[model samples]
Target: MRCQNLVCGLVLLLALGTSTVVQATKPEDTAATRAQGQVLFERTCLFCHGATGQGDGPAGWFLGRYASPRPRNFTAGSFKFRSTPSGDLPTDQDLFRTITKGIPGYMPSFASLSEAARWQIVAYVKSFYPGFRTETPVPLPLVGAPTPQLAESLDRGRALYTSFECHTCHGTEGRGDGPVTQAGELKDASGLQIQAADLTRPSSFKNGASLPDLVRTLLTGLDGTPMPSYAARLSDRETDAWDLAQYLRALSAESVP
Candidate 1:
């Protein structure tokens, strides 16, 4: 009985030691991960993002000529969807979300991919820009819920729409046919012509159509685009950004069939 007990103890110790080793070698942003990501990218993303991530793949060219928005150039380091502050590098999770959800009309959702594989791709994509190595992502502050007084909130939101001069780009009726858009004056950092979102079409929102998503856009703005961050511009007492978001939501609601 004593000899049998000793063997059991030895087996338990060996099992625990193996578990520790497995935990220690868990996958991270290592060379192996990047290489696996590269392979995945070549298989899935190279058609649109390209071998160099310049958004200049053959399919990209085909799409650019016919598509309104082109594929993103990772080399530019200008991501549109993010939880981070405007002009800041997005967190790993942000990239993961973009990969999972994708842009509405332009990018296809890769949610089918394993989460680990998606993260690996994110690591590889970040490799395109050296800034990712040195910069830490700064998350934007959380937005508060709309004021309890619904009508009063909408009223304030309407006033904020005018005060913020949103009509200059989104049009007075939220049709996206504002003078700037009419003149084709809006250009992204890449000098590519871009259009203001039609506020009436909530379904077309690239980031998302949720209230929180709208508020986040108002706070963080779309980097490399004309949208400017309101986080710094709005005063602590001013709930103007939230009001604006509310107003936008109302416009979208009106357009619903």
Candidate 2:
């Protein structure tokens, strides 16, 4: 009888240990974690994101016709700002950063929220799309740094820009007054009218203005906008995207006045 009782106690201890380990290793968004996220979304996001996250919140409608860009409709799974390739879903970190940073002119920053709460919101927002559950995000490749010779790089970039016909939409001076803009031909994936970004204004860049950010934008492109990814098009010996980024940085430095 004593031996049987000891054996039973040992088995119970091992079972409890296994259960604890499983719980510890588990990623977030269990039933309880998702419940917490749902609560946070209801309290803070419902006004702009809508109860269903369809971007049809009552407040969004009230923003009026002049609203240059409408609120994001999460259910469509089409994200504009991402480090991933065009047409790919953004990584969780990408979503988290967007939520924290927000779009300057369109969406307000949610930086006031706790980091944990923001992550929870990411989880909740991702729940709107089925692909978030089934698809794995592929990160865009990072190319080597720009060549040390600035003038040469700029020259190469300029030649490539002309060869690539970048001036058609971005203008020869990077002023966003290109032929496409003049013709009013720019539109987003939603068929909403959109303007080409004024490349001369680095401060207004939606996806950060750092060298790496610009390069990444060139490689990945902004998904829902008129921007097209150069990842596949650029040649190994031709205009390196980094050189183009360097030239763009130089353009931004030009006096705007």
Model 2 scores worst on lDDT over the 10 consecutive residues at: 17-26
57-132 in candidate 2: lDDT tens per residue? 7677654354346677889998887778889999877787778767756677787887777878888888889899
Backbone collision tally, model 1? 0
Best by TM-score: 1
Q: Evaluate all candidate structures by whole-model CA lDDT and list the values in order.
A: 0.75, 0.74
Number of colliding residue pairs in each model: 0, 0
Number of the top-ranking candidate, with lDDT as the measure: 1
> In model 2, which runs have C-alpha deviations exceeding 4 angstroms?
1-27, 62-68, 146-149, 235-239, 254-257
Q: Estimate each model's TM-score.
A: 0.83, 0.81
Which residue pairs clash within candidate 1?
none
What digit string (tens of lDDT, one per residue) describes model 1 on residues 49-155?
Answer: 89999887778876647424677889988888887888888878678777877787778888888878888898898888889999999877543444433787888
